[model samples]
Target: MRTRDTRSVARAMPWFLLVAVVLFALNLRGPIVAIAPVIGQIRDDLGLSAATAGLLTSLPVLCFALATPLAAALIARAGPERAVLISLAGILVGTLIRAQGGFAVAVIGTLVIGIAITVGNVVVPVVVRRDFPASRVGIVTGVYTATLNVGAMLTSLCTAPLAEWLGWRAAITAWAVLLVAAIIIWGQAAGWRRSVLGERVTAPDSSEAPPAHSASYRSLTAWLLMLAFGGQAFSYYGITTWLPTILHEVQGLDDKSAGASSSVFQVLAVVGALGVPVLANRWRPGSVVGLVGTLWLAMPLGLLLAPELWPLWSVVGGAAQGGGITIVFIIIVRMSTSNDQARGMSAFVQGGGYLLASTGPSIVGAVHEASGGWTAPLIVVTASVLVLLIFGITASARVESRHP
Candidate 1:
């Protein structure tokens, strides 16, 4: 009797799996990036405060923390295929509601999208590990990271005018249509279920899956990773919400120029996100983490001390920080012995990390209100980066898993 050719089956799954992963990634950051593009219109139309606008922008990351842990549990209950499909549908529906206008509705819609994206964020790694077991995990993560960047870049660039032409509500809501397209494509792929264990009703066994390591949350490495991830998120969100306004006010740029400049920062981030993981995979973990951390420290201070040098500094700094974040994600996968631990560790790190992240933009805004200038907030941001550097270095050292 002829034996089954597992190699051919493994090869066939990856091509389609890459497509599905990319679709899922394309929807991941639309909600976050889409808001900043048209935030002013939404604020003016609804008469919301600057602080409220910042809150609206940062709320999704806040929700990400709340919803991420549930992903592992939910996927266990609903199965990966259905879990992701439902999550995408949730994101689509949320985007539709946000387009309907009314500040409360928009916030509510964004919260829903936050929940959906969190699910996707949690599951994609697990799926990559399961679907491409033979491939290098870092490469799979690098592609995932790269596509997510492309998604964010597209939405950030497109959101503003689309809102202006079609009405802010319509432009914001239209992202739902993209989600709908993803859901349809993903559903079609569901029929090829026989190639795997049919979504095994439990998290993938992370113990023997990825490279192994010990993890104890109390370990300095764990604390450092958590702090580094949190600090990065906090700094990133703060930059995203305020950068345009800061440039317009401090640098005398017009509204259009300011927005355009801020968009450049995110565009640079795509390069960072795509580049960091690949490099981390190629180097000694300590050096890769340290170099990325140094960039993180320098970027915020560059924005603070040298406003005149922003065009060059911001792009380089933003890319470094973005790349640092991608490295963090890659480390989570690499440090874990199995997929289940990776997901669980990701949940622990991000849940705590984003809670730390949530404080960043809010505090910066408060500092801005107090000092009546960007100076204080910038100082706060610099200090945050230093903390990030400290933790990032600590985390880069060998660590222990929080799970069995």
Candidate 2:
């Protein structure tokens, strides 16, 4: 609440931002990850086809992609603070709508919720960069990544038990409460914003110093980074949506165990998401990122070929993949020369990434329907990773955009 800078709050900004990152991270995966574990049950209850079920589950992600550009426009106009608050509010409302239940309503609700997440996803990095010094960015990003995995882990694990006890709607609605909690904490910390990070807002030498950028998308480096980020996103959202169902249907695991396995994958992913960055940050980001793509290609194959062992392999694989994702964010930070560039880069990667990612689950489902088993879907996953690897190899370089 205090605007004045203090030695204590300055030191505490790292911790406070860490907590805020965790809160924001927690909000992200809960809505979408919660859907996968229960998809089978919902299909049976609602009598959905594989395609319909996939769309039902993937609707939120689709909206996530659709919403990013809009969030960017708003952030460009209104500032990140107002955009995030509005997003959090939308998440709460959407979760409540999903709680009311029935196939159409639930899908619509989740789509809205996903749109809300896009806003959070876009803004949090801006907040981090604005609030933290360069030396600490990796640590904060790693912690934030870990907290997001924690949320994803909880979302995967909690869905069934809560559903069993209170029904599916209640399970779905539970995450909304966490968003409400975040609003309160964020309010307390809003005053800390100015002290946290500096923005390079230069005055024009004349009335107009050629608008910041005529087009934000002109830079090849920016496109490469977005593609790299999208590669990671595509793999992550693909797995989160289909992993539980894959385990249950293909590996002969039960519903409960399948869900637990999915949760385990996410929990282990926390290590990857947090841990990889610690190591990767030391190297040339481009070299490190290519390795990330390689890991993506290898791990999912293991999951498909050896389903029984994936619970263990997933720990290794998920962490590697998760770390790759954290690296993607790190690249976004390192590649940009200025705050405006960083903000623009964030918008580009997230907007394109979510759009690319939104198709993963649905495409996986559609593939499964065509191939008659998980084999085809696994191949598709493998291919997606290869694409990611290619993108990361290009993006990992120390590159910055000349334009916005």
Candidate 3:
């Protein structure tokens, strides 16, 4: 009876872990993206300049860049599970601080939230690599990536309505409920604590040996991944921060309509995030990267040339951006030889990439303010897509050479 019970428990573990991953991912984007739709109100209420408002979005990403490397060290000391729990605590605290209703408080809260999220950004890929079979990496990545976008979509769609009904402060605070639920479920989940402690952990099915700790940081492949990820983040965050405003100012949509349009981008992104990985699993990610890059370019160009087709452009851009992010994470895991190396690569990619990305929103805002239009700002995004294409091709080639 004891042996049978143990076997049954073992069978159920993966599902529990999957649930935990999904819940965790759902918290990753909602809090940040929720601010985008209501940013005009936030700026007006706080008496912020465009640059300062841009900083509101860019600050957390800056934190993601600066603090991601610390995640590996935290994991080393506290184990992944405990480190994640600590991150949740930080999220909880940040949400509460933001809810208190002052611009200074909100900025400080966002910084804290960014620091918390940085840990999850670097650690989740390692968890997937450690827990799942090698063959399942793409699917698992797709699922989590999809879940992450779902959270963003919900925020984009709901934040305006929520703010209208509950006020922005309450709406921002509402996200904390999701985080709290995730924390509760994570604590009760079976096998999570053991897995974190590095005892009785399930080994991946692949035959490769563990990589030396220094290998990922020193390799050319890691640098390529960082650049690819950086390019993607730059484009994604820039669009996300300003898409609603761009629609409102340039495309002549109302604030509500613009917010809804932004949600459409996020909704389509979910499709891309889920679909890209499955396609990449069958085809070469390198080839897919070029296609995705073209889609990213088309979005801004469509907006520039034909603002009338904003809906179509939004969907295409969202899909491409979503797919680009998912593919980069997939490559990060596939290119590494072990979970530790994967963690290291994730840190490097997100740390360096996000630091590079931190400039996107502020730069876009400054350019918009200076040039007095959206054209120049969007051209910047187009350039970023081109960069994404260049590095993505090289990153995919590196993965093919290493894995094949």
lDDT of 2 by residue, 179-290 (tens): 9888777765665655453332322113222234324588666677677667677777778668888888878888778767666667777777666667765766666666
lDDT of 1 by residue, 1-404 (tens): 11356455545766777788888888998777888778788788899997787666678888878887687678656766887898898898888877676778878888888888888877776676566663366666767777777888889778888987898877877777778888887886676555443444244553544333334354455566788888788887777778888888888989888877676777777777777766765675566767776776676677777887778867877787677677777777666656556666676677778888877777898999999999889888777777667777666666422321
CA-lDDT, candidates in order = 0.74, 0.73, 0.82
lDDT of 3 by residue, 181-264 (tens): 999877866344454433454444253455644456777878887888888889987887788899999878998898778778
Q: Provide the lDDT at 221 for model 2.
A: 65
RMSD of each: 3.7, 4.1, 3.0
Order of the predicted models by TM-score, top scorer first: 3, 1, 2
Q: State residue 73's C-alpha deviation in candidate 1, in Å.
A: 2.1
Output the worst ten-in-a-row residue range by lDDT, candidate 1.
Answer: 206-215
Residue 264 deviation, candidate 3, in Å?
1.3
Given candidate 1, what's the lDDT at residue 221? 59
Maximum-lDDT candidate: 3
